[model samples]
Target: MSLRWKISATVAAVSVVVAVALSLIVHLAYARKQADDAHRLQAERIQLLLREYHRGSQPAFGSRLDDPAVPADLRAAVRGGKVATALRQTSEGTFIWAAAGTGDHVLSLRSDYRDSLGDLAALDRVLLLGSAAVVAGGTLAGIAIGARLSDRLRRAATAARHVSAGDPTVRVGAAIGGRSHDEATELAHAVDAMAGALQARLEAERRVTADIAHELRTPLTGLTTAAELLPPGRMTDIVQERTKALRALVEDVLEVARLDTATERPALSDVALGEFTTHRAAALAPDARVVVRVGTVVATDPRRLERILANLLTNATRHGRPPITVVVDGPRVTVRDRGPGFPGHLLRDGPARFRKGGDRTTPGHGLGLTIAAGQAAVLGARLTFANPREGGALATLDLAPAAGGEPSP
Candidate 1:
């Protein structure tokens, strides 16, 4: 159930319980008071009748001498020279009788308590209507209060989602005025503050990385030119190779910074996965096996798709054992390597820049999978890495949202 209904239901339940308890107490007290008054009035009438009998005057209508309507126990008590009273339930209703002995005659008076009982029943009806009103009012009030609270929380959660999606400028904007002290308002303020902090930190890091790569580019170009000018020798070849590796590292860093800014847009095109993977595998890793279980065509950026695929293939070849396999199965491509698989942390948290997976002695910098994931995001595809239960590492890229195909197997 939603928060609104839960709160409303809780309030309604409590109101019902409280109303029942109060109604029972009031009803019982009123019934007791009515009963006591009826007995007292009947006793007073019996006293007046005794006085009338002693004065040798006729008794009142409700009072009688030797009345057979009175209970035998009450008459016996009166005949014993004592005043007594008894209550009886009859076909008409409940009756109260009081008797006293006087001059060898018993004077008795009886009164029915039916009218007072009718009053109590009316009072019970009134209480039922009033309690119902109270419960209905409480439930409506609870619904209103719950709606307000749930709305505030919903807006805060939306802003948090925007922040998670990399729009650090998004703010909940609920912290305002006297209500700022409330829990919902406080949560909004916290989300805004967290987004702001993340924006500042990420901006600073990207700026530094971009600046360093730009500065290294000029020196790297000059170093490459100088090594090429040297005489053809083993030492010269070694210098050229190392300088080339350094230049590639600088370019990767620059690409990462660009992706972080999210300014790169995909150039979409229609491409067939079977033909594309076959060509890419041959060019990138000739020894890697390629299998197409289905023929699928997708609308996506071919260059970005190639970049993502290149990274996965390269990572597998460099860090995993031979017999790497790329399988295309209807809108999905999976690359697997028969090696020790990805590191535990890498699979758990995805890829991170400069945080190399597997053996630390691997030659390439750790930005390959990170770049691949960024490119996949740009193309609106999902790229996930895992170590399948049957040995090696697996990377699956799903482009189902933009794909059309018929599975062959």
Candidate 2:
């Protein structure tokens, strides 16, 4: 059940329990007080009868008492020169009786308490109705309070979801009703603040990366030209290779920064999945095997798709064992490599730009997967990494379905 309903039910249940308990107590107290008043009236009537009998004015026993209704124990008490009272329930009704002795004969007086019994019954009905009304009102109030709290919680949850989905502009506090200084309001403000802080930090990081990449391009070009002029030696070859790798890294960083800032947009095109995978696999890694089970067409950016595939293949070759497999199934493309799979953290949080995975010994600046992921996002695709049951890292890119009546070939 939802939190709102649970809270409402719990509050309603407690209110009912408390109301029932209090009603029972009040009913019992009122019934006892009424019984006491009835008994006192009965005693007074008995005393009046004894006074009349002792004053030489004998009253009629038939008028004062019902012989059949009076018990034998009450008559014995009156004959023993002691006042006595008893409450009795008969087929006729409920009654309270009192008796006392006057001389040799027993002086007795009895009051039929069935009327007082009826009054107690009426009082019980009133108490029951009032208790039910109290419980109903309390339950409704609880439901209202719970609904209000649930609404605030839902607003906060929605704002959190928006932030997770890359829209940091959503503010839970502003979206909710009048601002109260309650814990829920404070939590909403916290969520908004967190989103703002994250947006600012990511923007700052993107700016720094873009700035560094832009600054390195000119010097890198000069260094490349200078290296070409050097002698064809081992050292020259090493410098050129390192320079090329550095240039590639800088370009990847710039691309990722653009993707982050929404400055990059995909140029969509229809491409045959099977043919595209085969050609890209051949051009990128001819040694790797390409398996196309479902030959279908997809509408996506060919450049971004190629980039994503190329990165996955490169990572497999660099870190994984041989016989890398690339499979294209409809809008899904999976690249599996026979390696120790991905590190636990990388698989969980995805590839972060410049954050190396596995051991630090791996020769990569970790921009390949990051660039691939960012490119996939731009193409409105989902890229997920996992390890298959057969072992090895698996990278799957799910693209949008084919458009323009593109049939499977």
Candidate 3:
């Protein structure tokens, strides 16, 4: 219920109670007055007749009515039965008024109490009917207000859901009241603030991606040309290796840019972990120790998964001894190389971008694990960097499981 309805209902209830009380009191008082007046008029007439009888100087009877101190009119009235001897009874109860002289003679008159009660009853009916009408009207009005309030609240809720479901354009309507204007305005202003923040964040990320692509393309082109000019010897080998590294460098940079912009399309599907590990390990190194836990499949974007695996294998070859081991469980593809594990400090927060300080001391762009972890995250995987107790550093690329099953180990 709205505030207005609550207040109005309270007012109506109190009004009904008060009206009933007032009507009862007024009717009772009026009846009492009428009874008093009727009795007085009857007494006055009786007294006057008795007084006239006394003034005639008739012979005295040895009766109690002859006493001079008694009002003659009252005495005569009592003898002639002009005064009512028995009070008329009423629903309000009967009352008897007697002449003071003797108990036998009573100047009795019915009180107007019944009439007064009848009047009161009539008034009660009127008040009751009126109160009912008032209550009914008030209740209906309260319900109407409640319904309107509920409607407005629903509209606001619907608008909120619409906004949440990728339509930032939904808005609340104006509240039509002088006192409520500020609150409605504040709600609208808050939604505007949220929408503005999302727009700003998206714009900034796009600008960053475009800038990175522009800055690195030229150096990458020169590296490619230089690599092509070398003859096929040790020099050519060096040139070709450098050229391949440069290309990987450019691709890693592009991948990072795409990730930042959320432009990488994730193709989610169930891939058999054992088979995938076998294929990847055979392609990279035939002699590598590849371990496959049976019957584990996961949903992932394959291209991103391949990128992450390649980065880890390459990193392992550079820093670790030969016979790198590849393990596949349901939602995981781990590459562990039998190399001196990463330094403890690096394990916690892996190698920095382009920082060339490791046991291998390889002279090349150092964007391997950084790109691996980033791409794993994009594919909804957990990439853990840890040095194994047995002696090598382990990189576990954990992927999300297929629906309706626990995640694969």
Off by over 4 Å in 2: 55-84, 88-93, 104-106, 179-181, 404-409
What's the lDDT for candidate 1? 0.86
| Tens-place lDDT digits, model 1, residues 320-346 | 887899998878999999998999888
Give the Å error, residue 126, model 2.
3.1
Record all residue pairs in model 1 with backbone atoms less than 3 Å apart, i.e. clashing: none
Instruction: Check candidate 3 and list the clashing pairs.
Output: 47-73, 50-72, 50-73, 51-73, 320-339
Assess every candidate by TM-score.
0.84, 0.89, 0.46
Query: What lDDT would candidate 3 get against the real structure?
Result: 0.64
lDDT of candidate 3 over 1-409, digit per residue (tens)? 5555665576667667766677677767866676667566545643554354357633222223433444445455565444532235545475433232223443322223355457657866876787677667766766676555555556666766665543544554432222354554566557657756874676576577657766777887887787788677998888788778767666776766666554456888887767777887788777788877744767887777877887888878877887788877767777888887877656766666666454445655666777787777678688888887798878887777777644343
Pick the winner on TM-score between candidates 2 and 3: 2
Per-candidate Cα lDDT values, in order, are 0.86, 0.83, 0.64
For lDDT, candidate 1 versus 2, the one ahead is 1
Worst 10 residues of 3 by lDDT: 57-66
Task: Give the winner by TM-score: 1 or 3.
Answer: 1
The C-alpha stretches of model 1 lying farther than 4 A from their native spots are 57-60, 63-94, 97-108, 174-182, 232-234, 400-409
Best-fitting candidate, measured by lDDT? 1
